[model samples]
Target: MKAAVVSNAGPDWEIREVPTPTPGPGEVLVRVRACGLCHNDVLVGQKRFPFLGPGPIITGHEAAGEVVGLGADVRNRRIGDRVGVPWMQGSCGQCAYCATDTSLTGQTAMGCASPRTTGVTVQGGHAEYVVASASGTVLLPDGLSYEVAAPVLCAGYTAWSALTDAAPGPNERVAVVGLGGVGHMAVQYASACGLETLVVTGNPEKAGTARELGAANVVTSGTELAEIGGADVIIAVTPSASQASEALQGLRRGGHFVVSGIFPDGSLDLGPRSTFWARRQRISGSTHAGPARLAEALDLVASGRVTPMFELFSKDRIEEAVTELTRGTSRFRAVITY
Candidate 1:
């Protein structure tokens, strides 16, 4: 099997032939068709994030592929089923966090934890083949394609889960900060949920694109936060924690700010003035959608409500893709197609 191996870990990626991965008990081997390149993968690979994916790891998590084989104890998931394997590969299921919500707890944390994950610590997507647990695989709906479903596994789920509070209603106002991976998806999901979406990006170039993605309004950081700009929910998808905190002032009282981005270093300053004084303002965080919610998000994609903005790259083009994204030259999303 050919994989975009991290090599020795750094800015570049090496696409090399590696032994084919096999499914273990309760696991399945997926012939990966497409894998989403997320910013989180970059941070983890470079060892800049809180914990680098255990090492000697492949660095993709948002993947969609066909199940070519199954492990000994795997059932329900058929051999030929096409599934979207997310960053959260699988969980203990019996853990207290799994019983509540995996997003709120770290028990099911994949991609960057001990016990590892399919691509990162365990081995990930970005390869021709990968392994995943039956519990973690979300069956792609009838009309969804692997390329289209790939990014939804991670970026899409993060945005959807953050914007919707697990459930968003019509007529709601949602504010999305940053127009990168999670931010772009956030705009689309907010629109799909019937909210008036507003985007806040520091870059002027993203203003038009943000509006195109479903944001009713778009403003650069230099621009004044609109007077009636308050939203029912403010999602900080920006990597800068401070910018997210500024978004809080843009939200109306009783609004919630959900942070999808994890600042590798500095904290988003949530000053005491507005963070606590507001009647219903709350600070919440959502990691990724669980299996059921991940399924729901894929359904959102199947409905055409949200489309991932991805640029396809071939195996040999892994280095270029990484460089472009690293240099901030790529627009929207980037995907590696096998």
Candidate 2:
């Protein structure tokens, strides 16, 4: 199998030939059709994420493909069935946090409790073939293309998760910080929910993009959003912790501030702890959605209520895609077609 592997901590991402492994019990081998290139891939390649390596690691979480083989006891999914591999590759199903009632509370502990994330702790989908647990694989609707479904597996799903956690009403004003993949989806979802969508981005050039994505208004910074009207909910979708923290001031008191983006060090500078308590606001974080929420997100996409725009790249041009992501030049999500 041809795969993209990261060799070291610097680190190096190179295309190499490797033997494809057959599926073990309760697993399925998917012939990867498309994989979304996220900044998380860069973090994994740099060894900044949870990867503990002997050497190279295949890194890509947002995968959409057709199943080619299945292992023992995998009766629900058959050969040629389309599926998507999300970020939460696997989790301890028996844990209290993973229980149905507890998983949607936007708690970080739920993710920290015995979680196995794709492209982070395990070999992921930056290859011609990937083996995923059959139980964790999501079935894609027939009408959804692999390229279109790829970003929904992570970027769009995370936006759906964070916005659902905030639970904003139709009359509320919602602000999406950063007009990238996740932020754009957040804007669309918020607008679909009939909430007034406000967008905050450091790049002034993205104002047009934000507006196109259904944002009611666009601002260059968080303070500008506050000057207009405080947001009932502020979802930060930038990798910069400082930028996310600054957006907290734009939220109305008793509002929710959800961190949907991954930071470099996992450290956020939220200024004074006392001020956070004084506001009586709810601060939460959401990872990729659970199974049910993932289904809802996919349904929203399939229904044409939420759409993703992307720049398609072939697997052979993976380096160019990674470079464009690192340079923050990709206007649309980059999906690598196999």
Candidate 3:
């Protein structure tokens, strides 16, 4: 099988012929058709994730493929089933976090003592063939194509989960920080839910795009957002902690703020502890909520309520895809087609 193999840190990935993996017990071997490039893949390539080893890692968690082989104890999935491999590969079901509520089990990967994370703990879907736990894969809707389904596994899932985590009321306003891959989807989800959607982005060029994505209003900063009557729920999907903190000013009193982006540096300043308490603001972190939420995200895409904007790249052009992602030039998301 041909794969984009990472030899060392940085945006370096070489296409090489590697042995195809076979499905182990309770796992499945997928013939990857499309995989989305995420910022975390770049971070993994740069060795930023401490859980990652020295080198030669396949870093891609947003994979949409067809099952070619199934292992023992896999009754839920079968051969030729279209599935999506998410960031949270598998979790210890016996743990309190996972055993408590199946709906929130997807978050177990973050708190679980032992987690099988795709591209981090195990092999990723950057190659033509990848192994995944049968229980971890989500069935894709028939209406979604492999290229479109790929990004929904991660970016769309995260955005939808973050919006759910905020738990905004029916008449409340929702603000999305950033207009990147995840933020773009967040805006659509908020709009689809019939909530008043507001977008806060530093890029003025994205104002029109944000509105087109269902944002009722677009503001350049937190100040601008707050000046126009703050939102009841603010979902921050920007990688910059400082920018997220700045967006907090746009949250109305007794509002919810959900941080769904990965911030590598700088602490999240709460700004005066007294102000946080006085405002009665709530903060939460959300990731891949669970398979149920992932299914909901896929349904939204299948129903045409939410559409993902992405640029496609052939398997041989993996390097070019990563370059565009690192340079922040991708339309919204980048999918590597196998």
Candidate 4:
């Protein structure tokens, strides 16, 4: 099978032939239809901080495909099942965190070093076929196709997982910082939950994009952000570490700031009272939405409530997609379709 493989930590991708493997016990072989190119791919390729790798790894996580074969012990899913493989592969349930149903909490995802995934390392869905553990495989409804469902595996899932930490009520004001892949979906999800949506982005173009995606108001960085002045919940989806930390000041008394963006190594300067004052604001982060949350994300998309705006790219043009994205030409998410 032809796969996009990273031969070494560099600034390019190499297309090479790799041996296709059969499904092992409790595993499924998915004929990949599409995969989303996330920011993490750039980090992994450049060997950025927090990307633990000295070796090459297949760098895709958001994938949707059809299961053509299954292992002998896999019983929960059947052949021909259309499944969306989330960033989470599967976690060892024996851990203390898993015993508390934290897996159900949309945390504890499988890493590249997992046992049931593909490649020598964690081979993701950047290839013709991918081997995924049957444990965390969530079935996509029949109506959704692989092309449209691909981004939901990561962007949509991450938005939902972070929003879970900020359950803004109808009366609360919700601010979504950075109208990128995950932030765009965060606006839609916040709107669906009946919160007043305000989008904050440094780019003015994204402000218009945010408004079109259900955000009632959009605020650029230059403005005073009067529309969402006292936001009860602020979800920072920008990959700017400084912005993520400073977002804690945008919340109301007793409000929460959920930081999920993975920016480069950096720091933030905020007031000492941001967390200690009467507001008693809190901050948390999430990796990606787990099984049930992914199901919810799909349902939201299917219902026409949350639509992921993405630019589609062919598998051969993977490099172009990454470049276009980093250059800010591609507006929302980018997907590599087969």
Cα lDDT tens digits for candidate 1, 1-338: 89887656465678888889778998989999999888877876686644445446587888888999999988779989998777766555465555664441123573222334555456788889988887777889998999889888888888877865624456667778888877888889888777788888888878878878988887764124547657767788888877776777776667666777687667777676544553666778777656666777889889998888989988789788888888777767788898
Which ranges in model 4 have alpha carbons more than 4 Å from their true place? 49-56, 94-106, 110-121, 226-228, 272-276
RMSD of candidate 2 to the true fold?
2.5
Candidate lDDT (C-alpha), each: 0.76, 0.83, 0.89, 0.75
For model 1, name the residue pairs that clash.
118-123, 118-124, 119-123, 119-124, 241-268, 254-280
**lDDT tens per residue, model 4, 1-338:** 87777766476876678888588889898989998888877666666623332245677878889999998899988989998776666656666655655453334544322222223235778888888888767798778878778888888888988888677766988888888889988999888887788887877766667777888877664134533475778888888876666555566778777787676777544556444356577777666655777899889988888888888888888888889877867768899875
What TM-scores do the predictions have? 0.90, 0.92, 0.95, 0.90
lDDT of 3 at 136: 85
Q: Which is the winner by lDDT between candidate 1 and candidate 4?
A: 1
lDDT leaderboard ranking: 3, 2, 1, 4
Find the candidate with the highest TM-score and give its number.
Answer: 3
* Candidate 4's TM-score: 0.90
Instruction: Name the better of 2 and 3 by lDDT.
Output: 3
Where is model 1 poorest over a 10-residue stretch in terms of lDDT? 104-113
Q: Please, what are the lDDT tens digits per residue for candidate 2 over residues 208-229?
A: 8788888889987777888998
Where does model 3 exceed 4 Å of error? 51-55, 93-106, 272-274
Check candidate 4 and list the clashing pairs: 254-279
Worst 10 residues of 4 by lDDT: 111-120
TM-score computed on alpha carbons, candidate 3: 0.95
